[model samples]
Target: MSKVEDFEELRPLLFSIAYRILGSVSEAEDAVQETWLRFDGSATRPTSTKAYLSAAVTRISIDVLRSARVRRESYVGPWFPEPLLADPYEDPARSAELADSLSMAALLLLERLSPLERAVFVLREVFDFGFDDVAVAVGRSEAACRQLLVRARRHMAAGRPRFEADRQERQRLATRFLDALRNGDVGSLQSLLAADVQLVGDGGGKSPQLAKAVSGAENVARLLGTVFPWLVRIGVTFEPQEVNGQPGAIFRHRDGKILQVLVLDVLDGRIQTIRGVINPEKLDHLGPVADAWAADREVKQARREWG
Candidate 1:
């Protein structure tokens, strides 16, 4: 195949690799585009296009992540990865690993690793790339790459939640949780939540967000139960969707503008964590973002009128 054909064929895999490393869909796309530019400008073709492009994107992403970490140090409120609606690449042999690593929880765990370690783990553990290819991708010797993977695995294992494997069971629990949230049914909501469950938000100081993470099933249940009813009063609606390979929902305004993305961490038949990403900058890729400040005002007005 020609250069264009080979690059296009590998685009999805390249994006997946970059996204895992950087955790930003926009940054990952940028890395892929930059990789293509370098490939196109090269005087001669490499022996393996896959390895060549993968290495280019991984190095670019590692550099981007190093700079990004500095910005995140001063970011307001909690930070979460931009919501990914669907992963473009698929390998039947690695489906389970792909699904597990693409989760919001998994991505956040990966944030604990150094960029090199993260890249090594993604290429070797998640994508099942060979040691030689992994070393090439991250610009490390095979021995160094193995050490990076070991550290990555240790860090990830320290915080990884025991994810529920039954997809139907997860969906069923999520369905009940959403239904209870819609109806303001605190009892039903609490029943589905783990006793230590936490509700957190990432609004980046640009929208409404929790002052801090709210923990305990009762506290989380009550907060969702009270808040969602008011949102419903103002014509906000949520549609269930898969986000980052887990059951989630995209909330929209009455006019259908994007409001936020809510993802659940379901484990052992109960919801363990509830995460909401409401930063407009992080959400614009999904659709036209809603003015969350205006939405807050509308909710307040509706509350006063109801009283």
Candidate 2:
């Protein structure tokens, strides 16, 4: 195959690696572009393009992660991985292990790991790379890479999901959630959410979001029904889509501008977590968003609509 064709074949894999490690779509795209540039200029080609490209993406992502953590330390609100319309990785269905590593919960857990640990985990567990390859990717010796893997696994295990998600069941719950959310049906919505359900919004301070992660089904439902009533109004639209191997939806305003892209974490047949990305900076790649919209519009909209 030609150089471009080879890159195209491995693009999804590379993108998945970078996205999982860096947790930013724009950054992942940039990393992949840089990888291509390097590949284009190289006079020598590796025997296995997949391994070479995967290593390049992994190393690039590790560098990005190291820098991103610094930026996130001072971020405005809770930082969330950029919402994905669809997972850009290996098919989770064909590989259950892949799903575990790419899920939102898993990615969040990964953020707690040091960059090397994260890289080691992604390469060894998620991508099934050999220790030597992982070592090369992270510039560590084989034994050091093995130690990193154990540490990463230990950290990840502490937060590992209780059970594998049932896709049909998760989708059913998400559909019910969207319906109740848009209908302003609090009782029904509450029924579908766990008592300790948590809702986390990422606005990066560029937009409005929960000042902190909101917990409890009542609080989350109240915020939807009373605080942000326009969410249930007729003008808004909801489109069901998969995000990071879980049931999710893309929400848009009456103006057809994307507003929120969300993912639901279903456990025990109810939504245990609700993650929404409303920051226009993150949503702009999906479509036109009011990038300049007021950060506190949730409060203003509530008053304007009610009054």
Candidate 3:
């Protein structure tokens, strides 16, 4: 493949790495765009496009992250990563690996690290890049990279287990949750939620959101019961999709407008947290879901008609 083609092929991985590091979709995308621009302007082709882009993005993200810290500190309320939906990959195993890279709680913990530490940890732990490669990516010596990884590991000691659910299991759980929501069955929905479940919504003030995180299983249950009934009344269609590597659902209106993207963080057998991103800015990358889900609706209708 040509350099451009190779870079295009690596875009998803690059975006994944940046998104995990930065949390904000816009910033991560900017980091990637800057990396591409630098690559395009380079005088000589690098021997390894992936390595070069990774390094470029990591370096750029470090710079962006520093600036982001100031903004985050000054922000109005708690900051949250933009939630995502997990769409299936052709290779289920590969999909599982990718999903691990997008977990919300995992990403939140990463914010505690320095930018370089975040890059090193993500490269070594998440991407499985060798210490030497990570060193080069972050402009550190191999020994320093190792030390950074150790520190980063300490920082993530309280993280959830890095277990990836099988495709069938994820799909089954997602379907159950969606059905419960459609039917306004709060009891069934509550059963699927973890006891310490957290519901975080990001409208970026563009759409409605809780002023603070609605935490605890009971509170989340109350909110869901109140909201789901209205959501169903509005004629929203829910589709199972992958977000941040876990089973998630997307809600769309009857007119095909994308309403929100729901990402779940499941622990053991129940969902430990829920992230709802209704921000139009964040939804832009998912493209026009209106037609996409409309087509899906049509297919389902045909099946029912035939049946």
Candidate 4:
């Protein structure tokens, strides 16, 4: 295949590496574009285009992440990675290795790392880059990179678990949780959640949310129970959709307005973390979920109209 074809074939992998490191879809795309530019300008043909591209993307992501930290430090309220709608290319193997990579809990925990540590951890753990490659990409020696990984691992140990539920089991639990929510069963919600489950909302001060993270399953349950009644009063509905590669709910008001999106992080067959993104800025990529619900509504309407 031509170099152009080769580059096209590797775009998805490149984007995945960048996104995992930077945790921003837009920034990932930008990093990939920059990688292509560097590839095109190079004098020598790349020995392995994939490695070159991955290295370039990782380097670019590290720079973007460093600059992003400056901005986030001054943000209006608590910051969170913009949640992504799950795409077909999500690697099940990578997902399994990095249980919290796509989890809101994992993203929040990453905030504790320095930019270089974040890049190193993502490359080593999530993308399976070798220590040497990671060191090269992050400008560290292999031994130094190994130490960085060790430190990152220790930092994440508090949130890490010995076993994580399979995707099917997680979906099953999420479905049950959503059903209970729709049915107004507070007991069911509480039962599904881990006792210490925490709800972290990222409204970015652009929407309504508790000013700080809400902890404890019972407290989260009470909050959701109270909110659900008001939602029912307003004729709002909940729809199950995949968010950040996990089962989640999108709230749609009667007039077809989407108010919020919630993604759960399941661990050891229990709901351990809940991330609610009500911020308009973070929801922009989600793209008018009302339209998605309307599409479903249209199909249902057609079935009735035809029947």
Q: What is the C-alpha RMSD of each candidate to the true structure, in Å?
A: 0.8, 2.2, 6.9, 6.4
Residue 275 Cα positional deviation in candidate 2, in Å, after optimal superposition: 1.4
Q: Candidate 1 lDDT, tens digit per residue, 158-237?
A: 99856789999999998998899999999999999999999999999999999999999999999999999899999999
TM-score of each: 0.98, 0.92, 0.82, 0.83
lDDT of each: 0.93, 0.81, 0.75, 0.76
Candidate 3 least-lDDT 10 residues: 86-95
The segments of candidate 1 whose C-alpha lies over 4 angstroms from its true place after superposition are none
State residue 130's C-alpha deviation in candidate 3, in Å.
Answer: 2.6
Better of 1 and 4 by lDDT: 1
Estimate, for each residue in 1-307, the C-alpha lDDT of model 2 and write its tens digit.
9999999989998998888888888999999999999888889888888888888888888888888899999988887888776665666444888776667788889998999999889878887889978888889999999999999999999988653257788788888888788777788888988999999988887776777888998888887766444654435677888887788898777678787888888889888888988878788778798532542454466668775
Which candidate number has the best lDDT?
Answer: 1
TM-score of 2: 0.92
Of candidate 1, the 10-residue stretch with the lowest lDDT total is 156-165
